[model samples]
Target: MRTVHEVSGLAGVSIRTLQYYDKIGLLRPAGYTDAGYRLYDDTDLERLQQILLFRELEFPLKEIRKIMESPDYDRDRALEQQIALLTLKKEHLENLIELARGIKETGGNTMDFSAFDTSRMEEYAAQAKASWGDTAAYKEFKEKAKDRTSEEERDLGAQMMRIFAEFGRIKDTDPASGEAQALAGKLQAFITEHYYKCTEDILSGLGRMYAAGGDFTENIDGAGGKGTAGFADKAIQIYCSRRGAAANCSMEE
Candidate 1:
């Protein structure tokens, strides 16, 4: 076991930060010494390493806690994501260095700004965050899914896909039409019932994800047919905007 001071030296984390982590229930030492000093064992150190990795990825502490405390948290998966994100960061830095050298060689006349483009890194980080499920909705989802078997889970997923198939049937219609909007409402309610509380904000985010051209898009399209994911995203955006406006009106009243 290592004392708090020893951990601070070894991990390069300050004693105060470790104490704060303990206070916030983010990390608890393995035990306490007779003199009330914090004592951390190997397992505790391992958790701390995970926490530090998330921190280096710029995750908020609360989100990190939610992710690490999640029932579905997988250490190997987290490590893989961390390595991917870090590699992206490294490549980004290298690009900036190359751009700097170019500028220095050209007497600062280089007009190219491609190195400043961080869209790829940011997109990957967002995807990583979503995969980590570092939100209240994910926590609720974990609670709701904890007792389900694999077959049951598959059934639920298939049911959800049927909703997308409905979206596919209406892909040719205007997104703001009553039919599309109603379908969007149905999708929101279904998610709320089976997954988590699909608030307007969360639903809007999901809409974007559906059309983001990755697994979500592929799976949604596979369920609903071609262009279905984009159609659903459009409908969801309209639904969420109208709902948000109504909510604001109610608040004002």
Candidate 2:
């Protein structure tokens, strides 16, 4: 038998967190010593291991409880699935490293820049989930990323691409101008219509991303030539300010 402190130390979890878990009925001591101290046996240790594994995958506590009680639950099968996911992640990372090396060996960042592909960025994100210590938190973040249907994503992608293509032709355009603002309005509505129900917070965050990141910036800029994405960001900031909670993007009430 081991005390809660001993088990928590061994499991690399905080005592307070363990207490919360116990309060939630996620993992409670199976027995108590004569001194009224909590004690864990082998069964409790195994249960804790399962809980940790699920936590590592970023499964919500509600989801984890349901999964644990599922009739299809198989420990060996779950472990096998995790191992396979790890292997894929390793292979993907290796490929990324190879690609980076090739790009460096070739030349600098020109029109032929090798690292511009967007899908590579997506794959890198998937690999990062495994690379980071907490798979669960990453999973949670990813789940909230976007939940539009495949058809909706394709439609938005097509529409945005066309819009950018048109905008790209006008070099010195004022994004805050009425025409640009209208375009931004359409884009925001497109996001609301298709993407995960958006909020001002999410809309604002994405606007910042389009302006700042290499991935989003490049895609937005692809329309106008060099600075189109930045224009879109400015326009969006204004649009979101006007839209706010009415945008229906916020999960918050």
Q: What C-alpha lDDT do the candidate models reach, one value each? A: 0.88, 0.64
**Model 1 clashes, total count:** 0
The sequence of per-residue lDDT tens digits that candidate 2 reaches over residues 1-253 is 8998999899998888778877888888989889977788999899888888767645578766665665546677455444433443455567667777776887744334343444433332333223233444334544644575778667768887777666565536776678877777666666665444455555555565565444556776876689876677677677777666455566564
In terms of TM-score, the best-performing candidate is: 1
Candidate 1's error at 251, in angstroms? Answer: 1.0
RMSD vs true structure, all candidates: 7.2, 14.0
Model 1 misplaced regions, further than 4 Å? 1-71, 74-134
lDDT string, candidate 1, 70-172, tens digits: 8778998788667767766787799999999999999999999999987656765675688676578878988999999999999999999999999999899
Highest lDDT: give the candidate number.
Answer: 1
lDDT of 2: 0.64
TM-score of each: 0.56, 0.38
